[model samples]
Target: MSSTKDIDALIDLMAKLPGLGPRSARRAVLHLIRKRSLLLIPLADTLQAVAETARECLNCGNVGTTDICDICTSEKRANGELCVVEDVADLWAMERSGVFKGRYHVLGGTLSALDAVGPQELRIPRLLDRVPSEGITEVILALNATIDGQTTAHYIADNLEGQVRLTSLAQGVPIGGELDYLDDGTITAAMRARKSF
Candidate 1:
């Protein structure tokens, strides 16, 4: 048996992560090996802990170590508004901006016709239920600028019309751009300038 077999397997697994290729994974693994006591050991412990505990919030679909995420459970965030986003990453991006005071609803993904994804596939039904249960006065659609994202937003708007005020992030969100790529200032500006959908 080769002594480097386990290390090679680790590198292979790391390469599968987003934004990391084989070369980068190899370099990272080597660096981690050099800093084993400081970085690698702690990182391994954290990864194991997270792997065992990470779960999606039952209320809003945001990922956390609990049944409900911190944002969903916060009384301060229940400000009569709910921001709808396509993914957990988008929700995290919005939170990082520290601008939106209200709560959030993560849709998981856009409505994809080709992939046969529909409202039922996402958290649309749960979002609709939350509107009435939570007394949400406004819903800010912060979905991506992609075609599927807009389609999903429009569908939600149609379902929610007359029930509450519906709005979307302003035009500064470039076509095909995901919320995760935008700067915090741009996100804040788009949210502040949101218009009726």
Candidate 2:
């Protein structure tokens, strides 16, 4: 083992985090060491607190410091609109956007035949239960545009047909995006989802 074994191990662990490469992890570790009193110690304490208290919301599958997340418990969020997402990260992204006022249901993952992930593995059954139990009038399928995501959406739609108003997030060119810069798939989706203006 090297003299900096512990530091090397920290860098390796940090590199395992999403979007962080070996060089980035090394740089981050160095910065944290340089700013230990101001940043690293506080970050470590916060991480410990989160690790100790963070858990999944019982009703909606959102990760929070409580058994039920704030959104699920909020009366204002009882808007009869439930947005279905594939993961807690998707739920967080939607929250950050500050657009949707409805509650959310996290499916954990999509149905993947190769991965052997089915509806039971996800929160599909719980979602179905929530529609009637929570008096949900509409369900927005906010799954990703991948094949498995679409397949999961279709499955849920088929199951919930006639029970609630079904909708999905429109896919197309992003805001301020030029048509020339968009990929073929994005342009095609935009055309398909076009509306009369």
Candidate 3:
């Protein structure tokens, strides 16, 4: 039996993760093996714990360890503003900037005609429900600038025309860009300069 078989399998698995190719995965696996006690074991333990406890927030679709995420329950975040994002990664990006104090609504994904995705496939219904129930006075569309993202934003805007104030992030977020790839400064600028939809 090959002694390197398990290591090769580990590299293969890691390579499947985003941004990690075979070469990068091999290097990472080697580093982890070298730091087994300090990094590898702890990482494995955390991954297991997260895998078992991770769940989508019942009210906002944010990923967390409980049914309701901390942001949803925080009275401090009850600022009558709701930020809608296409994914949890976008939510995290907004949070990293610390510019938006309002609650978030993750749509899971954008509307895609090619992929047969629509409002029903996302969390649009829940978003509409939250607007009235949570007393949201404003909604900030923080979705990506991709065609699908723009399409999804328009749909949400049309459905919520007369309910509340609607706004979208301004400059800095390039066309066809994603929130996850933007820097904190760009996110802050875009948020601070948001405009009406």
Candidate 4:
């Protein structure tokens, strides 16, 4: 057996992670090995724990350690507003802003025709269900500024017309920009200046 088999496997797995390449993974593995007690062991434990327990929230599609996420279960978050996002990362971005005091609806992805992704493929139906059930008075579309994102937002707006107030993040968000890339300040500003869709 190869003496470096396990190390090679670890590097391979790390390389598969987003934003990580084989070169970076090798460096990271070396660093982790050097700091085993301080970082590696703790990171490994946390990864294992999260891998086993992390799941998408049934109500809003947020990732957490429970079937229902903390935001969905919290009474304080039920402030009659629902912020809709194209992905869990976007939801997390909004949370990092610490400006919105409402719950969130993660759509999982945007509606795409090329990939054959539709509203049914996303959590659009569930979002519709949550509108009245959760007493959501406003739905802030915090999706990215891409064509697919805008298309999905418009579709949602059309579907939920007159049921509740509809708004979208302000125009400062660059075209094709995803929420995850925006700074907390920009997110807060966009949320604050949201206008009717």
**lDDT of all predictions:** 0.93, 0.95, 0.93, 0.93
Q: Which sections of candidate 3 miss by over 4 Å? A: 172-197
Off by over 4 Å in 1: 1-3, 173-197
Native-vs-model 2 lDDT? 0.95
| Best model per lDDT | 2
Per-residue error at 95 for model 2, in Å? Answer: 1.2
- Which residue runs of candidate 4 sit more than 4 Å off their true CA positions? 1-3, 173-197
Which run of 10 residues does model 1 get worst, by summed lDDT? Answer: 1-10
Between candidates 2 and 4, the lDDT winner? 2
List model 1 lDDT by residue over 1-197, tens digit each: 25388898999999999999999998899999999999999999999999999999999999999999998899999999999999999988998989899999999998998999988999999999999999999999999877899899999999999999999977667678899999887788779878899
Model 4 over residues 1-197: C-alpha lDDT tens digits? 24298899999999999999999999899999999999999999999999999999999999999999999999999999999998888888899989999999999999999999988999999999999998899999998978899999999999999999999977656669899999887788778877899
**Candidates, ranked, lDDT:** 2, 3, 1, 4
**Model 3 poorest 10 in a row by lDDT:** 1-10
In model 2, which runs have C-alpha deviations exceeding 4 angstroms?
1-5
Clashing pairs in 2: none
Q: CA lDDT of 89 in candidate 2?
A: 94
Better candidate by lDDT, 3 or 4: 3
Against the true structure, what is each candidate's TM-score?
A: 0.86, 0.93, 0.84, 0.86
Residue range 32-149, candidate 2, lDDT tens digits: 9999999999999999999999999999999999999999999999999999999999999999999999999999999999999989999999999999999999999999999999
Look at candidate 2 and tell me the lDDT of residue 64.
95
Question: Highest TM-score, which number?
Answer: 2
